[model samples]
Target chain A: MNEKAYFSEQIRLYEQNIYGLALSILKNEHDAADVMQDAILKAYSSLHTLRDRRKFKSWILSIVHNTAIEHLRRQKPTIDIDEQYDLAAPEPTVDPETRHTVRAAIEQLSLAHREVIVLYYYENYSTGQIAEILDLPPATVRQQLFRARKALSKHLNKEDFDR
Target chain B: MTTPSDRDIRRQLEAEGRPAVPDFVHQMTEATLAALPEKLPVQRRPSPFKRISAAAACAALLMLGVLPNVSPAYAQAAGRIPLLGSLIRVLTIRNYTYDDGSHLLEADIPHVEDDDNAEAAALINADIDALTNAAVSRFYHELELSGQGYGSIHIDYETVTATDRWFTLQLRVTETAASSTTYLKYYHIDRQTGRHVGFGDLFAPDSFAALEAAIRAEMQAQMDADPQIDYYIEDEQPDGAPTTLSADQPFFFTENGDLVIVYDKYTIAPGSMGNPAFTIPKSVYEPLLK
Candidate 1:
């Protein structure tokens, strides 16, 4: 296949996933859109050099992550300790305050830890998959997951499970 | 009584409603496609002979014998042109102008091409020295390879391109012992405009023997040039060996002035070198540079 067709096909396959990744990181829809636009511009501009087509998904995802980080660093958006509850999560049983508390607790964790949580929890990535996506060792991914779990546990410990 | 297990957190987060993604995403692919230069106007209804010519053009691209000259432009556009490998820490591009004017970009390398010629040259020199050190160290370790008749010996740097907004650096290395050459180029991409303003090339000759001879000659020259400078300071033998080390080997200088040499097959002295001329003390460096 010609280069343009090949790249456009790749873009179609991964567009939603890339968008989802950006959304998880940026939180706000508008910011996520901006990140997505920038990432796609970059991806399309550099599409010719993908040596291993098999790894394209992961490669695109990495670009998105780095682009999001760059945008976030520039903006330095303020995170409300309470806004963490917007995990966009469907835990309706949990009270708003409690959910917010748990999210806030998750937010308090370092960026490294937060990335693992976002990947595993929101993106539904397996440990091995997450390892490749983040360019981290498997052991490191597992450790971050373990720490994220521990942090969540501490927050839930202060409130009842049913409430 | 639902427990918030790892799987549960994942499920809950995934279950939440995702906001509508912006419209620009779907448009991005189209925009990029639109930006492409129009193909040369060829006859639409070519005869069978013309079709054969088209097929021949495609075939030529795949011919293994013609590998080197096949338009590096594709690789650069693909962003797969290994921006960096061993020996290169960074690549920064300078000023960039878009023919289509879709995006114009410019980048600033802290150590290169800022109105200060002396400062930029010194930074570039240090970068070269660090790369040299890496090449020498790699030669040092490749020598330790067991039962191998093969060895490599060439190392050098090349300038890919330097402009006001775009700079390209390619770190080229060849290992004769391994019968392979690695090419890595780092692009300091400009944020404001999408251009690379500067570039670097870190290359080694194809033969281990040649690489070694060249390194020894370079080191000897450096040593003889400044006999007054101490070549064998404390910890010169980073691994506690009595062998001496040189500072020109792309040594890593932390913000704190810690000197660490990152050569092929070797990484030495994490936090020992005194202040480097490139760096101000942390108290001063942080406030000014950061």
Candidate 2:
């Protein structure tokens, strides 16, 4: 009914998903935390203009994405540590010697791929939900998942078996 | 052997995200909730014709010896009539000059009172207005003729601080995309109260771009009365920040010393009356309120 109760309820409903969205974009805990703060702050500031209740998740996610992109722009370093390792054949993940390598490979993928992976696997969102959250077509989301899987499989040194 | 299923891949990757969100988010939410205003400021700028008329009025007043000698009380009362006249003319897209002091052009959009979806409807209504304005005029006409589309007009309102030119109106619209039921938004500024109130539409629309043009023509004339500044749009980012023709951050400087910036993005749509009209934040162009 009141502004406080209104937004607080919204936060309660999608806060975790929002955090998860930010984490997918930022990767690291500290940056993701900062992005979360920025997203929530912006949403709070602009909440008065919002009219639709059903689109809150998508709306909030859009805010989170914009804030994250702006933050990333200011930082100027597009960091994807795990993505680089994915390019190279990684070590066996069952062993600790290769677990770090596997992690590195995951990070080495492009931010776009990493985003799909994070949303699909890490956040437990279906491809459809991920597509809506990211404002992408469902087919595109499916394709990204396909590519992300191929890339991750290659890095895990399981391309032969996995593919 | 078959490859790992998409579901399997999804499960494996889901493990990588943060195990938990920090405790501060709750604290931040509390702080944010506490910080939110009881009433949200309407962000719509005044209509373009209102801005032009305001400018035209100033130019006319300065040319006549009448502006300097005019008393504050006489000017205030006189100022409103021209604005009301100009706005009615501009919004109707017909030339009209009315001397009647009692007439006020009011656009009403009735919406649902449900709080859950009000904000989204408000945002969409505004967005649709802005998007239509930015789109080419022919594109706008196509939308209009199809009996299904949205449109918007850019309005800039301004006047000297000495002259009291405040534009006020109550706007209402519905957003069906957000809910099954309609919502009503009361977009009005109490010139006496200085209070700006806005909410969502009351009913769902088969087509949301119902009232874009009529409201635009009406609001445009209201804004054209104030002559504070003029602007043109360089670029617009839907779902992102607007890029303005202004060269500086916030308000930019020109060879002449006037505060100028592209402040509004209007949407055109069908109204409750089934007429096309515009909707946006009145505050964006509230610079003219000065």
Candidate 3:
């Protein structure tokens, strides 16, 4: 296949993964759309720069990750530490009624923790793959995964009670 | 009340439907695909030994004083040899490419070394190489720190004018991070004295004010004549008056000898304006030319 056709097919194959990753990082549907658009355009323009065709999936995911982070940085220059640490105290509760609540709780986690959880649990990427995509150390990814699970559990428990 | 188990969380996450690709994304991708060039840029990989041989041959020819008697076709043929094929007069000496998956650099660089203007040529070539190398190293350094996405730097050049008396080279260095940004630089050489020239060398001393005024008037007049052509004068100066061109402002001479002033993106207008350039007729600056 031609370069454009190949690129288009790659985009089609990974469109859902790209969008899901962007949405997980950005936590807003509209922002995720914008990031996806920007990342796709960027990937298309610089396709020649991709030396390894085998790593195309991870390569594009890295672009999306960076683009979303850049967008978030531009939107809010300074992140709130208190907001990240304000995890709800976990309480024993029955399983939630809908997956929507769990997804919403995931979105409530800080950008750093949320991304690791989504990549690990949702995308099923290994810690090494997540670390590579996020440009974090494996140790950091594991720590993030640990913290993210706690935050999610607490947030879901609280979310269930609030509902 | 009990917290959900990791298995339950994973199941719930898996159950979460994949976000649908927005309709606009598909439309935008299609539009982008349609807009892309039919052929991807050809990656030229000229071997180093061949380049050295070509340069040695050219230098030997120059030392033998054979270039003057040689046919233009022979001169042109020399350029088609290998690496430095185009470097004899106004050609790219090296179009370097480096891609290690994470970082990529492509530079179309010039190498000019006239027997008469050897010093000036060497200085200009060194300067260009230094700039390109610095940009490459900086990009690599940045990528090393933030290895999130691919980083690239492209350095392409255009020979604006190549006359016996004057030679002007325009270099565009585009560095891509999340988005691509381009910076423009111009190199001018006085072939006779073998001296690198800048804005100051082009005109008579004390003639800068008149030249600036003339350029501003011409740009403003052009903007007034064409609705599609709007400069950033209004955005730059709230009063909407043309700002005086700086003495060291970037510029080049067209083959017709007209002065073309170039502004980097976001300097005079929004990036949509994209490196705005205004050409002033030769007649306007005739008296000012040194």
Candidate 4:
């Protein structure tokens, strides 16, 4: 396939992965969506630098990680009145009454913990690969993952009494 | 209440990501694809060998003694005493330079002078004229497009290999607009045969496939060895990526008689990989050589 076709295929295949990654970092769906657009376009423009097409998933995710962080940094001190609503936690898709599903548990974790968990579990990236994508030391990623799992277990154990 | 294991957590997360992407994101993806040019712009890569053979400009010439003093009186008297016999010389016959701030052009046109081999000289000269002229014409065309200058094409030549049996001339052309791109063309002549030799000429008709496969293997090996190195091996680029060598593929025989296959900058790899060349030992392809 031509580069454009290949790139289009990859984007479609990984769009959800891209969105999840950005959402985990930004926690604001609108901002995450914007960041996703920025990162994908950035990856497309710089695709020539990637030596191996197989590494494209990780490479693009790394770009998304960096772009989301930058967006977080540039956000204004005072949220716009309309945007403040988006900043609030997104409503849970399932287990509406409990509000303690694994998805909700993941949303409650710190950004650092959330990022590692998504990369490790959702993307199936190795610890070393996660460190590379997040630009964190491997030790930090391991520590964050360890702590995140502990917190998640704790969060999930306090399950729905409504069940 | 039971806590979830890592696998359970992963499954749930995967489930969360499974819903269809938002309509807005699909639109954005479409828009991004639309924004891209129909053809991906091949990034201009710097030639890796450029540092080794810098074409230092010698815009003018002053060679009085070496060349046949083709003075009108001398020409009339002897008719033609074609200089030192069989001596090979390359001199900058003309230098075209124009720089009005934005648009600049530097063309150091060279002539291959071989007194005993005028045929070879004429062949090389004609080809060089065509290349430089095309480059110059494009430079003017682009210049006229914008009232302000866009870029320049600097054409220069370097003799990469010159031996009693073989002579290889490498012409490097660099064109720059918003960015710069550089490509190379090599011309080789077999002194013994009094004829030009190239990728196809040196190989048997049936050897083309083997030669292409060998070059492709080298490309894969290079990328495997160095993660930073990349070739458009199977980028499915209908045009730029090569599954076959050009009839006059840029190549030269080393003094050691090793056959080197060369692709111009941005030919097989991006501009950053520069001009890629692989040297195959003479023995490997000895049977294939004509």
TM-scores (chain A) of the candidates: 0.66, 0.67, 0.80, 0.81
Whole-model lDDT per candidate: 0.43, 0.41, 0.64, 0.65
lDDT of 2 by residue, A123-150 (tens): 5667655655554545566877787767
Could you give candidate 4's per-residue lDDT for residues B1-290 as a string of tens digits?
34456667766665555435678877876786666554444331233222221111111112212223212121122112232345776767656666666667777767677766778878887777656655555455455443332367787888877887887888888876433457687877788887766666787668878877778888889778876565666653313345567566778889888888877654565444556898887877788877
DockQ of 2: 0.15
Top DockQ model: 2
Residue-level error in angstroms, candidate 4, position B282: 0.9
lDDT of 3 at B189: 82
Tens-place lDDT per residue, model 4, A89-161, is 3332344334465666777876677788889887888776676566454555677788777767655643432
* Alpha-carbon interface RMSD for all candidates, in angstroms: 16.1, 13.3, 14.8, 8.9
**Residue A87 of model 1: what lDDT?**
39
lDDT of 3: 0.64
Candidate 4 ranges beyond 4 A from true positions: A1-163, B1-86, B234-240
Ranking by lDDT: 4, 3, 1, 2
Off by over 4 Å in 3: A1-163, B1-94, B100-102, B204-206, B225-229, B234-244
Q: Model 3, B174: alpha-carbon shift in Å?
A: 1.0
- Judging by lDDT against the true structure, name the best candidate: 4
Summarize candidate 2's per-residue lDDT along B1-290 as a digit string, tens digits: 13356665544444543456678765675565566456432222222111122333334334333323222122122213233332211121111121122111111112211132344434433432332222112122222232221222222222211112222222222221111112221232223333332211111232123222223344456447633211112222233333312111112212232222213321111111122223333433333222
State the weakest 10-residue window (summed lDDT) of model 4 chain B: B52-61
iRMS of candidate 3, Å:
14.8
| Ranked candidates, highest TM-score first | 4, 3, 2, 1
